[model samples]
Target: MRNTLIGNGVIIQHGGADYYNANIIRRAINNVRSGCFPSHLYPKECADFVTALAKEHNAALNGDYDRYVFTTYDKASLKDFKSRYDRKHKHSPEEIGFEDYFLLFELIHNKLGVKNPERFEHSVVLRRMFLDSVFNQGKIETINERFSDGFVKWLENNDYIFTTNYDSNLDVVTRLPVHHLHGSFNTLSEIYDPNSFRNQLKDDLLDGEEVDLNYPHLYSTCLVSYVGDLKSFSMTQSSLANIGMKKFVKGYQDSPDIRNQIDEWDESNVLVKRLKEAIRLKSERPELQHSEQYPHKELNDISGALEIIGLSPNNDGHLFTQILENENITEIVFNYFSHQEEADAKRLFGSKNISTRDVREFWLDVDNK
Candidate 1:
């Protein structure tokens, strides 16, 4: 069987609230709220925090207060941090949007730059944003190229299978057996270019672009329409309509068998058949399949050597844990970036044999190290 290596929040420069980036912001807020400095301290304290954070994250901190609210903390220095968050946080609820939240996170990251056990609650929000494609991860096409090369390289060099709770951008480029555990981001609304899905878009896809392989089918200029005039819109028409329909249906739901059949709908779904096909396709490629079963085939031989990174082993996800436990598979590798994360994962999965690593080192190649 071939080995498997997985990475989350490693290659991407940004991540959710639990992410290394956003947590910096969370830490700063917690620090200020917890008396890291006296309440009477000068706003310069905020500046200092931002500068320290910039140095720690290696992000350049730039932009005035107004602009800072919308910026993702990329690479800012102390000077940069001060310039951004030295203002008051007195905006009304009306001024707050996704961008405000993103910027507020940036402020927090800049402020908590040096505090120990940095809290990036913003990064947690950021992670959820990514999951939901809130701000769409800035400059879609360029990011996609960056991510694609990284993913393909990992798949080709590392003899491993990857399971992503996110979508499957890797499958399109690397053609590896990527199991999209929650579906992908490949959709028409995810790109900046109008003709993203067309072959023409591939011309723009350089060696490491961050394509939204799951959110939308492809990157196109039309995706910008999805974020059109956020202020005027309470919720996207499509999303609101779906929500209304869901409420209506759930209020008067059907039976389990009907739902099961609906879930098993043909052509669009193709789960059981897809797994069967994937198994058949790999039968001839034992070296690649790693002896794991297809969807229908029993995954009995798989020792359940689950390598979890950038995820909470919460009760909501207990079903996945149960899958492994029921199979008597014990070997596991759980990696986390912070003290809080470590404590959380430990509480859920226990301290036994769970190796912890910083977010920075979580995805590094062991062989290379």
Candidate 2:
């Protein structure tokens, strides 16, 4: 199958996708207090953490803070951002939304430059801003241009699409299969539903059955949306590095203390163990079983050439690493929008297996053809 990776950049040009863009999310974040946060996101234990941070950030800024929030895109350099922000902030079990802020911003913010508010706990009264901004975004849509047309054609040829975007912009416009690497609003919201068919399959998914998705891992991973300029990978080092999945790293600690194995986690003990077995069943287990029954895992086993567009090198490190290591994938066609991005693609993908293209040229050809 031919495979293509669609990134956030291509959809940013579309109007419907503007809802989840940083500006909208940021504005909502900077505005609400909720008496107790979004009706859905706030834990009864903690009133509101994320909303309060925005209020405080607002109080601290004598002038507009927007000018400064976006200035430092790199997390390493963000240390010098403010003496107050220098220290690493931690989240408690009640402070779940704040940690989520760190994770989601990396995936969705793309370039809108959202800030990981310093001292998330201080904003306990902060409204749950993500759901507020995301849930109300009417309908997300994308059109048949800018490779959407070409992507549609490729679907007929059995090409696979893997996108890091959380919105169903492509799904709305094309109704094609889009594997959202970090998860999306639709999937996440459905899992929350008590009666949804996907939610009903939760147990089967956990039991390593050909059943769809349960919670502890994949569901937890995608439904989670945190708001950050901290960069997605940098924010969740504890989850990915410690061998615990980032989505399950929600617990009370001055800093997140994730375990190296699933057996150690006591929260959803059984489901967690089953999640490990499920992943193990699909990941390098002796049987080489599970196979295509696991469609998400199959995203990695791309055998034909890969055509990539709009994917950020920083968003999903582990997946990118696998793509680099996969021998089945013939060549990576990395598309860039500018000279600087061309340089970034060169550094990230290297020359050994990748050939670069200017996005404008490629799509113009597609639209022309």
Tens-place lDDT per residue, model 2, 229-298, is 3224433432343354223333221133433444355546755555554443333333322111113455
**Candidate 1: C-alpha lDDT:** 0.39
Rate residue 166 of model 2 by lDDT.
59
Error in Å for residue 205 of model 2: 18
lDDT of 1 by residue, 1-369 (tens): 332434444334434443333543444344445554323312224534443433323222233333333322233222433343423443322222223344345555445462423443334323332233322333322333544345456555533455432344455556766543322344233223333221122233333445444433223211111111321122133344335434433433445664455445464553444433333333333222211111212223345455655554532242244434534445556667677777777666662445566655644553233
Q: Give the top-scoring candidate (TM-score).
A: 2
Candidate 1, residue 187: the lDDT equals 29
Shift of residue 142 alpha carbon in model 1, Å: 5.1
| Model 1 ranges off by over 4 Å | 1-8, 14-144, 147-154, 157-160, 187-301, 314-319, 326-328, 351-353, 363-369
lDDT of 1 at 40: 31
